[model samples]
Target: MALPLLIDTDPGIDDAIAIWLALAAPELSVRGLTAVHGNGLAGACAENAIRILEAAGRSDVPVHLGAGQPLARKFSRQGWGVHGSDGLGGIGLPPAGRGVDGADAVAFLAETLVQAAPGSIALAPIGPLTNIARLLREHPEARQGIREMVVMGGAARENGGNATPHAEYNFWLDPEAADIVCQSGVPMTLVTIETARSVAATPARIARLAAAGTRVAGHVAALLGAYVHDGRSDALFDPLVIAYLIRPDLFVRIPAQCRVATGEDSRLGALLWREASEGAPHALLQAPDPDVIFDLLAQRLRQLP
Candidate 1:
């Protein structure tokens, strides 16, 4: 049986690919998608989630809108440059065919997990931790239902950041929320910006799949094609979350402890992670074969539209 999943996201360009991947995967069942602010504004982020599900013909998956800004910080759109003004690289996919299921993303997250069987559901957060953090604070009871959370976040040390000199956008966008989730003591696996960077969707790779002549792949290629190519900005960061869920063996998991920089500065939203003692609940994940991951992307997305 497929493990049930709930994705907390912001529908960045790569986020669209991740949702497509989750829908295509046979080992997971997506119960819903909740949107937060990161790649774009909250309204656009929620709309993008709806559009993604509709495009993949998975409109049955409900979409919920969360807060438009971080829990303790004033909103800023500095991270919007990479995903473009409208996100999805501004390829202009049609507006969502349906509206969001409700106004509260945190409530949706808490209620869904609480209602599911204990340890039967997995949560994937592909954006800033705003919604997940809110859910954790408001409903600590729901944590018991989550089997394991696979999060896409943090800047790799080598890159410094995709957002700032010392921070990845997701963690940097909301350092307070990331800090809360990190210290929540929940079982979590983190996929870093480096992992996302390693599996880039370069023009060559994207074109090869676009030529397959399917609606889904072509749409994905067009959106990805519009990505701001700052040499390495077109990395498919979010999809790897789905791939990890399907094949954990393809990744190296190291037990670690993390601390987020919540102050406003160059290092704000930055995460400092260090290897931890044995059996730590938190881990950092890295992919060993990006080629195999790309193969999985092509094979699974080809199954859609």
Candidate 2:
């Protein structure tokens, strides 16, 4: 049976790629995409989600708009520059034809979980944890339906974060919400920024992807070209979540206790990792073949529109 999957995202350049990857993968049954506040404004993120689905020709899949900001912090002018004036690297991949399926992502998520079989659905939150936190807060029973969550935030240990010296963008955007989810007691698999940084989008890789000749690869190459110029590290971070799900052999899971620093300043959303004991339930991910992940991306892109 195909794995039931739900994606909660912020529609960054990489988030769009990840969503496309999920839609392209036949092994996953992507129930819906819930938008949140990261990489851009919430409304823009929703639009980006719809636009991303349209690009993939997966309009049948639902797109639910979720929290506009963090649970405790006020959203500011962040993520705009990171993803360009528009979320899709200003590549202008055409607007979506339809509107969002729903406005309440938390409620939709809870409903979807409750209606599905117990421990049947998996969540991939590749954005801020605002929507996930709200769902866990409002409908704790939904936890029974969640099989696992593969989160693409946090800066594991060294290398630092993109938001500040201390925190990554998604967690830094809403550390409180991240903390809530971390403490929500769901089985979590953390794909940290430090681990994802290994899959750098080099110029040679971009050229090879461009030369793939599929429509999906062409758009992907354009998006990468736009986002990865001027010596940017060019890590397409989000797609690794889907790849890990599809190819578990490519990664190693390490048990760890996750603690998100919820400070109000520079230290906000810093991820602290430690040894996993009985108290520690989360698993930290390590990519064994970060370069091969791009090959997986190419293979999957060939399967999509």
Candidate number with greatest TM-score: 2
Q: Name the lDDT value of residue 204 in candidate 2.
A: 83
lDDT of each residue in 1-305, candidate 1, tens digit only: 99898999998888998898899889999999998988888788999999988888888999999988999888887856767667877676788887889659999888888988899899999999999999999899999899999999997594568778888888988899999999999988999988787877777788776875678888777877766354427677888888999888898988999878887667887878899877898899888676687777778877888
The C-alpha lDDT values of all candidates are 0.85, 0.85
Error of 2 at 37 (Å): 0.9
Q: Candidate 1, 144: how far from true, in Å?
A: 0.8
Give the residue spans of candidate 2 off by over 4 A.
Answer: 277-279
For model 2 the local lDDT of residue 80 reads 68
lDDT (Cα, tens digit) per residue for candidate 2, span 1-305: 88999999988889988988898888898999999988888888989999988887888989899998888888866646767778788787897788888558999999999998999999999999999999999999899899889999898765488888778888888999999999988989988888888888887888777766788788899888877784444886899899888887888888888889986656778997787765467988888665588787887788876
